[model samples]
Target: MAMAALTAATTTATAAHVHGLCSSSSGFNGRKLSVALPRVCAPATSKRKRAGGVAVAKYGEKSIYFDLEDISNTTGAWDLYGSDTPSPYNPLQSKFFETFAKPFTKRGLLLKFLLLAGGGGLVYAGSNATGDILPIVRGPQQPPVLGPREKL
Candidate 1:
């Protein structure tokens, strides 16, 4: 399992660049015209191809280019975005995915299992302790609040 996770995290990925140029017309025609930079590729969204990351761009009305690149630079995980807000990183899902993508050695598998079990146990224990410290099962009428407080 560990080997698999490692292998997966270290797989080849893809990246893309998105940018656009501008064109304008001038009036009165006196040293007038339009200027724009040569289309330079913008910062890209990169991720592993297996993770379902693809790049798509449209140039002319009838010409649209779409392809994937080799972008192994990204680790942990990544998601594609089409707007200003990038996608949130989902660690839990990515962990499961990375596990199968890579080949794992026996030792690696053992370590992974141990770590996951230990972490999960710790989290559960901590949650239980928290519950014990504050026995508040929030409900519609309960009006959950921290500490002891009478209704105002």
Candidate 2:
């Protein structure tokens, strides 16, 4: 009963097409660089939900998520995702491949591994400090998927 009205809203969802080449560091650690200069927009969405449509996405500093918005005259549903943070189609993350997520593409594998391993060791520890069962957090955060919020 509650889901029908939410479905009435219209739709079209896709990845954004942000412009600007990610310039490389001149030296190993050159002067500071920039991505999309912050333009004013509504405060970015924080908590995720599914009031109208089942939208699931993730956000990054430079638009790596999906965007949904409202049409001026439509009397239907709005379809969107993520923080609408603005990002173009990632060449690295196609349907079949994600070999070079932004971090890796920018910082290489060795550095990323060292950082993660070092951080995790300090945080999680080698031996099980607590005896109770625990779930290992998969990895770097992906957009939270809010939904049927049900169990399988």
TM-score of each: 0.20, 0.17
The segments of candidate 2 whose C-alpha lies over 4 angstroms from its true place after superposition are: 1-93, 99-102, 108-113, 126-152
> Please, what are the lDDT tens digits per residue for candidate 2 over residues 60-133?
44644443443322334444424666457775456335644545656577697888899989777747476444
RMSD of every prediction: 29.3, 35.8
Q: Enumerate clash totals for all models, in the order shown.
A: 9, 7
Among the numbered candidates, top TM-score falls to: 1
Query: Which runs in model 1 stand beyond 4 Å of their true positions?
Result: 1-19, 24-33, 36-107, 132-152
lDDT of each: 0.52, 0.49
lDDT (0-100) at residue 24 of candidate 1? Answer: 26
